[model samples]
Target: MSHPQIRHELSKIETNLRIEIGQLAERKQIGIDSQGTNLCELIALLTNAALSDHPLFSQLTKLDAAFCQLDIGLYGLCSDCESEIEPERLILDPVEQRCALCAESYAHEHRHELRLTH
Candidate 1:
């Protein structure tokens, strides 16, 4: 994706994350920042509170990482090959850090690990 598109996409992701956090915080009576909260720490707190119906913690972590990568001007680059990630893949999940080639390779390399976790 181009830089402008990526910035727009990240904005949307941020909005969604904020909405989810707001709803979850309201329901749990937890305090959250209006902007710039630490995603991992906030989620950890929510997890400790035993929130149900929340997004998976790992998913939010990926999103938080995406925002950080964008801040560093590396949002659309693959973590492995450093190539630009396919635009379609980014649409499906803006948090993806691997391009198609590396994703397949990584999947093969980590298949056993995934199975164990699952």
Candidate 2:
């Protein structure tokens, strides 16, 4: 996708994440990039560790990693296959980590392992 499109998607995801983080943290932090780090730290401290088994924590961790990938110019690439994820999918969900094929395969293999606990 074009840089502008990427930025649009990123901004959308950032906005959605900011809302969630704002609610989860109970205090909104201003700014992007830097605030992602700060909010992650605050969320982590709130989670009090041992949250890898939790889905929301995992999603936040993955999105935080996505911001790191963006910093390194690898944001939209699949983690398993190293291929560029479909542009539409990325635009729809900028935090997505896998291409369609890899995602399907992963879901097939890991379906039983998927569970969300509150």
Candidate 3:
């Protein structure tokens, strides 16, 4: 995709991520009342688990960093090969910094390294 199109898409994603993060924070801040019934307490516990270490929260953090990179004009370049990332891949995940081949290679190497360490 063109730079402008990429920028526009990333901007939209960034905005949505920020809004989601804000909502999640608000939910966290409204602590469940200790005096509530058992059901309420159970619901609150489930909500807490959903909010904490959730994939959405992690994605928000990643997208925030991606926004920073976009601001500096380095969004679509593959980190490993310094090649332009495919536009389709970018559409699938604007925060992805590496092309498919490079990402697979990196993952493979990382897994191998983990095996060695273990």
Best of the candidates, lDDT: 1
Question: On lDDT, who's better, 1 or 3?
Answer: 1
TM-score of predicted structure 1: 0.64
RMSD to truth, every model: 3.8, 5.3, 9.4
Better candidate by TM-score, 1 or 2: 2
Candidate 1, lDDT over the whole model: 0.77
17: Cα error in model 1, Å: 2.3
Model 3 Cα displacement at 6 (Å)?
A: 1.9
- Model 1 stretches with alpha carbons more than 4 Å out: 1-4, 22-55, 114-118
Report the lDDT of model 1 for residue 86.
94
Preferred candidate (lDDT higher): 2 or 3 = 2
TM-score-based ranking, best first? 2, 1, 3
Q: Which stretches of candidate 2 lie over 4 Å from their true place?
A: 25-39, 49-55, 114-118
Error of 1 at 84 (Å): 2.0
Report the C-alpha lDDT of model 1 over 3-25, residue by residue, as the tens digit: 77877887787778777777767
Overlapping backbone residue pairs in candidate 2 total 0
Worst 10 residues of 2 by lDDT: 26-35
lDDT per model vs. reference: 0.77, 0.68, 0.67
Q: Per-residue lDDT for 103 in model 1?
A: 96
Per-residue error at 55 for model 3, in Å?
A: 2.8
> Clashes in model 3: which pairs?
none
